[model samples]
Target: MAFLELNDIHKSYFLGKEEFPVLNGIDLQLDRGEFVSILGESGGGKSTLMNIIGGLDRKFTGQVKVDGRQLDHTKEKQLDNYRRGTIGYIYQSYNLISHLNIVENVLVSLDMTTLKGSQRKERAIALLKKVGLGDHLKKRPSQLSGGQKQRVAIARALASDPEIIIADEPTGALDSRNTAEVLKLLDQIAAEGKLVITVTHSQEVANYGTRIVHLTDGQIDGDTRLKPAYPVPQEDQSEFRARPLSAGASYKNAFKHLTFTFWRNSLIMLGTAIGLFAVLLFSGLGNGVNAFIENQINSMVNPNSVTVFKNPTGKKMSSTELQQSMQQFANDPSKLLLTDDQIDHLRDLKHVNKVEPGYQLSTYTVSYNKKNSSGSGIQTWTKAFSDNTIKTGHKPGDNEIVINKNQAIALTSAKNYKKLQGKTVQLTMQWINKKNQPIQITGKLKVVGFSDNAQALAAATNYHTMRQLIEKKNGVTKANYVSVNVTNSIYVKQVAKKIQNLKDNNKYTYGAITVGDILDTINQYVQIAAIVLSAIAGISLVVSALMIIVTMYMSVAERTKEIGILRALGERKKDIRRLFTAESILIGLFSAALALLLAYGFSSLLNHILYKIVKFNIVQISAANIISTVIIALVISFIAALLPARRASRLNPIDALSAD
Candidate 1:
């Protein structure tokens, strides 16, 4: 059993059922510590044989045994392990990753081992120092001369401490001095008890090896031994352990590549951030405007109370029918009027603190001395109204009225409005009777105080006085609406629901309305507006995803050779895909961060300007909005990169390495 064996090996290429033999009946045996050179002409099979021995060209028929273990090319993982741990390759073109520094290039091979963190960096530095290029560790491949680049490649090949070093035309691109230097390094590597195999067509390159094997017409023609092989030293087998490739290493590489093209990536991120910013800003604005409207409405009424109206027909009514019913009730109080029994039933309901009967007359007139106002609406005062919503007025007593400031201004001048508070005024009201006949009623009331303008343009009076005046004229004493006050604001919605479910004569006869219901309707419309604006902004994000797809495809095309290099260095197809995917996710994260920053800054400025006008912060961005933005960005970015990543992963290593 030899250290490495190739028995009766045969290889051929096929083109449309035609076969061209590259290697035939080649038998060879080699041991460690030997600098062996396979020499042949350009059309001969020297490179083909080297490829088979290096486990790169596995489609050949042969028994390839290393240290008495047969090589099974059918298993992909086994081949990957063989390439990663058993052999190292040095290409003729000095295929170095352009974005990586010299030290990083070497570390790419060592990253597959268990050596962690600082230990891997130290090993890469040591290998570079051994190759006489220690000071150039931080320099990229393009910054170095051809000789220096070749040295870096050599250092990278030796970083993993493989058993065999396979060099394919390693000195083809070097000058005489550099060639001599590389050959001397190869000699020293062989002397360190490792097999050094060189494949070349030049006699001068082959002469430096201790043994030379000649190939002609796909067969070994001759073999010559120049000196005795060095003795194999004791190997440190414990240092070589199988370790899975690190995803962190791939991400680091992707970050380096992204930063190398920072300006291009920044432009893409800016475009993406603009779309995200628009969505977040519009959503925040909608939230703030809805909140402002809710506050205004809540301040004008008791949120813990619900207003109930009688449904005269005892059935659901259409919008037009409901409007006509309300108008008829205003013109004639007998229509759709609630009785005293109904009010008492509401007061006995659960969570109901008290019930307030209220009447509104849309047709009315008043006379104060010589000046009188017509078309003035009148409302009866209740406990709920006087306790919660009245801003500056005392409860009206019998025959006393409280009018809004606007109504006071309408009747008299602003300066004389204060003096009218204690003055008496004559009130005359007219309405249609139950038989559809017209009727007139007259009464005298004194002005008590002024209420807030939010109570609408209605004159308020005591419930007893309004009822007495109505009954005296045409015998109408029913209330048009009733106010049901709940014990707490939290139970307003529940109580309102119960009131709406109340029935009269086996049909629902009442409708309830709470401040929360009004607010909910308003907020619903606001959310709809926000959604529409966000959808428009999302069109730009679609365009941004297309931009990402185009950019990733371009990156794959530009770095085709780098993809090949990674494949040759024992990276799986999934690893290649993850590299591109990781880069895209990083772009998404950066764009999301930029959008958040811009939204915060703009919201601050808008809030400052709005606070002066509305006395409230009117643009709020919530945590949910931020989280949703980030998730949207990442999902779009990942979907955009999928096609390009799969394309890069499926590339053939040999074909990619051949690409310019």
Candidate 2:
């Protein structure tokens, strides 16, 4: 049986209900070891017949049989397998991918083969050398002459070792010498026991083959024999076999194209990078701001200290809920006053060293010599106040108080501020009793020193001294809060959790607040502001995504022919789709890398400027932030390429291969 046979093939084109027949009832029988030229004049359907035989035009009514087995051309997968495994196509226009070098262009075919990476390159180089273009392996088609480009195309066609070779107008644009060289190569290919078919209008090219089949207006009018077919030779059965392109190869191709157009893509990367940079920068700023605030507060407060309060809700609350309850408790201090049992429970905590019951006045005032220094915050001294907070003198003892440094300086002259220590001052505040009756409390206290910090800007005294002054008056008083000192800082949270979980009458009796908790509350607001800014900056990513979409669509349009070439070379639709997506993802990754650089650069400069004033680093990028930026960039780029890649993948190979 003939190695390849076409039976009763008919194909037509339709334009608005008008039928134009291109091929009519074509019947042919050809075997390996023969160079068959389909000879015809213009519009003789020579190329059309070649397309059908090559499995590139499967829309026609055709029963194609190979090696005594009929091919199911109606099935796309079958046709793809036929093209990739059995057919090798050499085009007149030398359809070499513009972005790929000569050797890389050949690998486009070899990548479909089940060959090792090294073997694919080695075979590609061998094929290029066989075609006498070994010296031009690194050169692009643009750098090669017409003949050299065609040689590269020939090398690419033979790379995967297909059974049949189809050359369409192979020497239409070449000189006589180059045309003769190409014809001789076809003869050599046939001599290797491969079926070679060439379609041409020239009789000189026709006679160069072993058999000449004369075609007239889509019909074979005559079959002429120029010479006998070459003798069949033993072939290597273990050579690389053609298969579907793998995902890795698709990505490799995409990367090659990406680097080939890096300059144009760099602009797109820069635009996308700017958006990622903004988000990362703001996130880092939030991180730095939180760190700085926590550091300052931590430095001025003892971590081992947790302030215990009477539970207003009698239930655990998240940090956000606890903040809302602060004002409610402050306005009604009578409700927040802790009983003796609650104070004892805090002292009973396993890790607790001591518990000091205290009162935090929402409003208080100090007057010395008819001059007043008023404050909205006044808390009795506890271990929560670090020794570093006191700028001068020692902690206030007995009936002595330490006020805000700025307020102390305001009431007394700055130079004599230290002299105010040991001077008697009148402290007064309004408080609510157990019966909710408001009463005025006053005390004559001596100033011991001043406390200075962002958080500690208030008047304070020993808890017992404040309790004594309030009790000495005709008003009833209670401990509004208790400061629990833990044996170690590491156990602060564990001990605090225990205190907060303590219950009375099966209801939560107390809540714990620590310096870290307060800092966390402040950081929450900072985080929100950062997120809002990042979200605003995220708008630019949308624009960048649109840019990517536009660029990908433009890429599909530009690489239309390359897509056709790949499809003709047996690439699956999925491979084509992934090819473009891989390129977009590369764009995204490169953008992320660029964004990381930009974010770090800007953060360093901003922190440098900020540290001089605040004495703290105010912009810190974290690992999580960097990772999020990369994932976001990839997702955006992937989503942006979907439609364009789909469009590219669904294009008709016949139409795409014919594109200008």
Clashing pairs in 2: none
Worst 10 residues of 1 by lDDT: 383-392
Give the top-scoring candidate (TM-score). Answer: 2
Please give each candidate's TM-score. Answer: 0.86, 0.95
Model 1 clashing residue pairs (backbone) = none
> Candidate 2's residue-wise lDDT over 1-660, tens digit each?
899999999999899999999889999999999999999998989988998898888788978899999988788998898899898899999999999999999999999999999999999999999999978888999999989988998888889888899999999999999999999988999999999999999999999999999999889999988899999887667566888899999899999999999999999999999999999999999999999888877777888899887788888865456557867777677778787877876666798888888888888888988898778888889888888778787888999898888777877888888888889999999887657888889999998888876256577899879989888775666788888999998898888888777788888887778887888789989999999999999999999999999999999999999999999999989999999999999999999999999998998899889889998889989999999999999999999999999999999998899998
For residue 139, model 2's alpha carbon misses the true position, in angstroms, by 1.7
Taking every candidate in turn, the Cα RMSD to the unseen true structure, in Å, is 4.1, 2.2
Q: Which segments of model 2 are wrong by more than 4 Å?
A: 312-326, 329-332, 432-437, 487-501
CA lDDT for candidate 2: 0.89
The most accurate candidate by lDDT is 2
Scanning candidate 2 in windows of ten residues, the lowest lDDT window is 317-326
